[model samples]
Target: MLRALIYCLAPPPPTVNLVSNKSNVVRGKTVPNGTVSIKINAKVYMGRSDAKGLFNIKITTLAAGTRLYVTVTDKYGYTSKERVVIVVDRIPPAPPTVDSITSKSKVITGKAEANATVIAYVGSQKIGSAKADKYGKYTIKITPKKSGTSIKVVAVDGSGNQSVGKIVKVRP
Candidate 1:
């Protein structure tokens, strides 16, 4: 007597579609049978597509002009592709320097990168702004709340890139 056996198996899943947006976000479409995983800097982030085959992946902001390696993999062990994205930033101006107080004056002067924009902030309020000269010199008139008032100054480049903030204390 001869015996016959029957076996059934499913075919491989569909390929994943991926796209990276300008705002540091990645979108993709995946198969319903599996979730999508993104790897960056040795860290793996996992997610799945919806019924409409849509997915959104959010990535952290990186330093200006930096690069991040990213890849996408589906549940069925299918990987779409590896992508390298450079962090896009305006590259803020250098920190500004507050000149020594030779006298008590409302005009605050500082040295910054040439052609930079200097903005003074007292707490959360913006006191004023000044444009740096060709020599990297900037001056802005700020109303002194009082002696010992803490102030923060930031420089902005023409491309809207902002520099690291510099802190200075007001003294009489």
Candidate 2:
């Protein structure tokens, strides 16, 4: 006599949002009473889902662009397909530092987070944009404006996070 037992595959994959590097917890949903596991670098973390299929697991801080692998295992011991999550940068760079600008000046120079994009604006109109070098130095060419005119400079990181704007006044 041949006996056959049917068993379902692993629990459905969990759902999670695109997380930031600053995130310290991973939350998601899967099969009720199932187990969820996360792998980051060489570390693995495990947690059980609630009756509502929700799970929250704490993790150490991750650097931007780090990858996390998640899986859910049903009571039958079957594991679901692996899910990949990537960490992003959510922290903005510091405001740019601007050198003194005179009405006769033809360029704006400053330092910001390395490789960040620097944008200069006069009111709502953008004057110019430049990318900071590895040394955090940048220069933007612009036509000389009237003395006392105010220009705003901001630094944007690779993740599109903008820093606070710095105000620069055109000197006589």
TM-scores, one per candidate = 0.47, 0.91
Model 1, C-alpha of 35: deviation from truth (Å): 33
**lDDT tens string, model 2, 20-106?**
888999988888888899999999999999999988999998999999999988888878878999999999999999999999999
- The residue-by-residue lDDT of candidate 1 on 1-172, one tens digit each, is 1222111122233333333223456565554534656665666666676776566767664455555544444454555444555555545668999874323657779899899899989899998999999999999986655767778889997768788888877777
Count of clashing residue pairs in every prediction: 1, 0
Residue 142 displacement in candidate 1 (angstroms): 1.8
Give the range of the ten consecutive residues with the poorest summed lDDT in model 2.
1-10
- Model 2 C-alpha lDDT versus the unseen true structure: 0.91
CA lDDT, every model vs. true structure: 0.66, 0.91
Model 1 scores a TM of 0.47
